[model samples]
Target: MSLDDKPDNTAKPHDRLAEALASDMAAVDALIAERMASENAPRIPEVTAHLVGAGGKRLRPMLTVAAARLCGYEGSLHHNLAAAVEFIHTATLLHDDVVDESKQRRGRPTANLLWDNKSSVLVGDYLFARSFQLMTDTDNLRVLSILSNASAVITEGEVLQLSAAEDLNTTEDTYYKVVRGKTAALFSAATEAGAVLAGAPEDQIAALHDYGESLGIAFQVVDDLLDYLSDAETMGKNVGDDFRERKLTLPLIKALAKADADARAFWTRTIDKGDQREGDLEHAMELLHATGALEETRAAALEWADRGRERLKVLPESELRQMLDDLADYVVARLR
Candidate 1:
C-alpha cells in the first residue's frame, strides 16, 4: 500500500502529535510555501512543489517544532527554523534521487525521473541556499552552527556511502558511521537547534540531541529491513531495490559476513560484480533468513529505539513527551 493507503484516523503517535500541534504546523506549512517561492525561476517552485506536495510524514520539521515547544519557546521563529529543516530534507531527497537514479518517491515519480537530472540537482542547490537564508533569520548563531555542521556531515556521509557501496569489507562500525552521518546528523541537529533557540539548559539540549540521534538510526535500520521484506506497493519501491543497486545494507552485510565459500561467491557475483540472474533476489533473501541476519538487524533497531525512549526521560514529563516516546516504538513497530 502507498503512504496514502494508511488509515488517516488511526491514532498513530505522529498523527496524535500533529493534531496537538496543528496550529503551529499550519504556520510551518505557510512559511514553507512562502519561502520556497522564486520570482525569476518558475522551475524552482515547480520542482520543489512536486516533492513537497507528495505527502510525507514531515517528521524532521515536526521534531524541531516539538522540541521548541517542549522547551517553552513562545516565539514564531521556530516556525522559520522548522521550515528551514524541511527545505534541507527535501533538498537532500532531490539530490539523492539523482544519485540513486530513483524512479519513485512517496509512490510517485521522482523529481529526477519526472524532470531532468540537471533540474533536480540545481533545484536541490537552490533549496539548500534557501534553507541557509531561513536559518539566518532566526539570528541564533548556535542554531546556524548546528545546521551547517549537519549539512557538511550529511554530504560526507553520502560520499562515504558511495565508497562503501558493494564493498564486502564494510563492517558494522562503518555502517553506523554512515548512518550517523547521512541520516542521524540532520535529526540530531533539528532537535538540538530547537532547544538552543529556546535557550534550554545544557542537559536538556543534550538529551534531545541524543534522542534524535538514536531515533534516526533506528528509523534507517527499519527502512533497510523493509526494503527486503516489504512489497513495492507498501514500500513505494520494488523489494530488493537495495540489493539490485548493490547497496550493502545491514541484513545483506551481516549475511555476507557469515557466508561460507558458496555464499561468498554468490554475493560476489550478484553484488560485487553486479551480474544478477532471475532468482537472485529470492536467493539473497533466503540467505538473509538462514543466516539469521534479518532477526539480528531487527534486534539492533529495537535497541536503538529503546535508547531513544530512555533519552526522552530527561525532559519534563508531559503528553508531548509520551508522544515522542511512542514515536520511538512506532519506528521499529513495522518489524513486528
Candidate 2:
C-alpha cells in the first residue's frame, strides 16, 4: 500500500505532515517503485520490495519534500529527489542490518536474516546506484554534490563507529562526529538539496540545513536513549542492542564518563572484553540511572530539538513550517 493509504486517524505530527503532502508523497512512492524495478534481475526487485514494503515512517523523504514545498517549489522534480532520499535511507538500513548482524528491523525480520548477507549488501549497493541515477535526473549539479557528499560522510561515520565500538574511552567529541556523519549528514543534505532545487534564498537554505542537522542529532540521541529504556516491542529492535553490540552511544558514554571504580570495571568487562554475565544488562541499567545518564541524554535531545525549532523561525510562516517545528518536538516526545 502507498504511505497515504495507511489508516492513521490519530496521526502524530509527521503523520499529519505526510497527509498534508499526500499527493507529493504518492508521487514519490510511485517513483520509488518504478526505480526499484529491474527486469533483468528479479532478485533485485524481490529484495527491494521486502524492505520497502516494511512500513518505515519515511521521515527523511518527507523532510525533503516538505522543505521543497516550504520554499515554494512548484515542479515535480522534488518527487524524484524525495524518492532518492528514501532509497538512500533504505540502502543504509539494509547495510546496517548486515554490519550489526541485526535479526530484526522495523519490528520485522531484517533483509539479511530473511534472505542472506550477500543479497542484503548487493541490494543495498544497487539502491545506492539507483539513488545517484535519480539525483542525476534533476540535472542539478548542486543537488548531486550535496547528496554525494552525504553518502561519503555516511560511510565515514559507519567506519568511525566501528572503530569506536567497544572502546569505553570514546569521547563525546568522537561520538558527535559519528552522529553528524552517519545520521545528520543525510538529514542536512535532504533539506539543503530541496531548498537548492527550489532555488530558495541562501539564508533560508542555511536555516533549513541547520534545522535538519539539529533534528537529526536529536532523533539519533532519542533512539539511543530508547535502546536502554523501551522494550523490544516498543522499540522494534531489541532493547540494549547497543550494549550487546558494545556500541558507545551517548547514554552509555555519559555513564562511563561518570563511572566509579566498580562501574568502570563492569563496563570494561561487559563492553570492552565482551564478557557479559547474566544480569549484566540489569546492572548496566542501574549504572546508567545512578550516573543520571538517561536523564542527561534526554535533556540533550530536548536541547537539540529546541535548536531545530529555533532555526525554523528564520523561514516564512506556513503550515509546513509549523509542522516542521512540531516534527522536531514529536521526535523527542517519546522521552517525555
TM-score of each: 0.96, 0.95
**Mind giving the per-residue lDDT tens digits that candidate 1 earns over 166-231?**
898898988988999999999999999999999999999999999999999999999999999999
RMSD of 2: 2.8
Candidate 2: segments with Cα more than 4 A from true spot = 1-10
Taking the tens digit of each residue's C-alpha lDDT, what string does model 2 give over 1-336?
233344354678987888988889999999999999999889999999998898798899999999998998999999999999999999999999999888887778998998999999999999999999999999999999999999999999999999998998999999999999999999999999999999999999999999999999999999999999998778767789899988899999999999999999999999999999899999999999989999999999999999999999999997678889999999999988
Cα lDDT listed for each candidate: 0.92, 0.92
125 Cα displacement, candidate 2 (Å): 1.2
Q: How high is the lDDT of residue 86 in model 1?
A: 96
Question: Residue 130 of model 1: what lDDT?
Answer: 94
Candidate 1: give the clashing pairs.
1-234
Error of 2 at 26 (Å): 0.3
